[model samples]
Target: MTVVPPLTRMPHLRHVLAPVLAALLVATVIAVGPGSSPAAAQQAGSPPVVVRGGGWGHSVGMSQYGAFAQAKAGRSHGDILRHYYQGVNVGGANVPGEVRVGLLQNQPSILVRSSSRNGSQPSAPVKVNLGNGQIDVAWCGGCAPIDWAIAFEGGRWVLKDTSGAIRGEGGGPVTV
Candidate 1:
């Protein structure tokens, strides 16, 4: 299904992946955060965040939905692939071996450890440096604080951010 070749699998995945992957994954849970800037670049007033579509990834290939559309329109696998991945002759070269399965949480555990009140959510999205801060993930003040209570569907630690925490899940502390 996932055409990601094998040469990329590894134990290194656990560490190298957590932070980087968490930062990247966290952006998906909401529409806009505190600021109004795109995530790529930040300014003095506000940081930016771009909302990507089609689940995730480049979305250049046979999107299952797209495939369904094409299939309904009577397109073959080759046609679907061609439509998504431009300029690539597909024959049969060599797809290395790589496939790993792990659970990824849909909601992040928000604690707001320090509660510093990071500022300035202008008329735009804010860019969080998220520097090498310790893994102190907690909900911040906003419409919906990061949902830290809900147990994920699979229990696998999701390496996402507070913004990307589970939808409609954030709120005041989860009282027992």
Candidate 2:
């Protein structure tokens, strides 16, 4: 007569049971359908399962190719911008000769020169001359003074301090 060993006493029984349990789990999942597991479905409703689709990148926002097609179909530049950017107004006017913009500390600034005749006559080049000492300015009447410095290096503008350490750098315009 043949004798069978109990599972606890049989060392090879674990190896055989592992594969059987795995196959049973796979079969149960296949029968239950994708994302239909009790835990997942209860945590969040079952989401749609996509099969096939074609897109170069993300689907959010306007497509550049669609904008190009609209332009080719006789839509103006402003029309294209307005369509892609909702709640936006597009308009243009002649440039002005001289315009002064108030500046703030550590903010980027821009200077624009235009030869259009829609505004005041062109004036001499604007300049900001700093002394050899460190720049000292206050934020408010009772605020403490802040020290800064400005210099031009390698065709770019640099803002530094008394220690010659660069605080900010850019080209195009000067910042206070």
Candidate 3:
């Protein structure tokens, strides 16, 4: 003979099951109540039992993972951008010949390199003018190139010349 403990003897179990049993009872009542549909009954409940859900994120821009998935499914670059941006033309405009490439965004200083020749580093790093986004390289033999830098300074982005003078500032963010 098996003797089962009463609900009073199982306080923890009772506590865990009470809300669940109550919900089930309420759901059943709402599901089978006279004349009214389950959906309508649920919508008209007192103190309203509601359900909510979340979505991807709070961005109005392209999702990187979504774009990657599209690419994997053989979508072209223009197709991917169009799908995300909506009704935007995917054509090229006249871009600056030598644009300031932002390599290290969060760094104080960056060491720029030259790829003109093998084992030949520029005497001074090529500093692109922040004002015009132009590189003034002195091609005279053995002349040191002017050092250019893009650095985060004083709570904003700045373009500095070789002598550490600010040429340009505050363009939101510098991108390649």
- What RMSD does each model have against the real structure? 18.1, 29.2, 24.6
TM-score of each: 0.24, 0.21, 0.28
Ranking by lDDT: 3, 2, 1
Error of 2 at 12 (Å): 62
Q: Between candidates 1 and 3, name the one with more favorable lDDT.
A: 3
Overall local distance difference test of candidate 3 = 0.46
- For candidate 1, give the lDDT of residue 88: 36
- The digit string of per-residue lDDT tens for model 3 on 24-79 reads 34334321222332344333333333222223663434566887799799997668
Better of 1 and 2 by lDDT: 2
The Cα local distance difference test for each model comes to: 0.35, 0.41, 0.46
Quote the RMSD, in angstroms, for model 1. Answer: 18.1
TM-score order, best first, reads 3, 1, 2
lDDT of 1: 0.35
Please give the range of 10 consecutive residues that has the lowest summed lDDT in model 1: 93-102
Q: Pick the candidate with the highest lDDT.
A: 3
Q: What is the lDDT of candidate 2?
A: 0.41
Cα deviation in Å at residue 89, candidate 2? 0.6
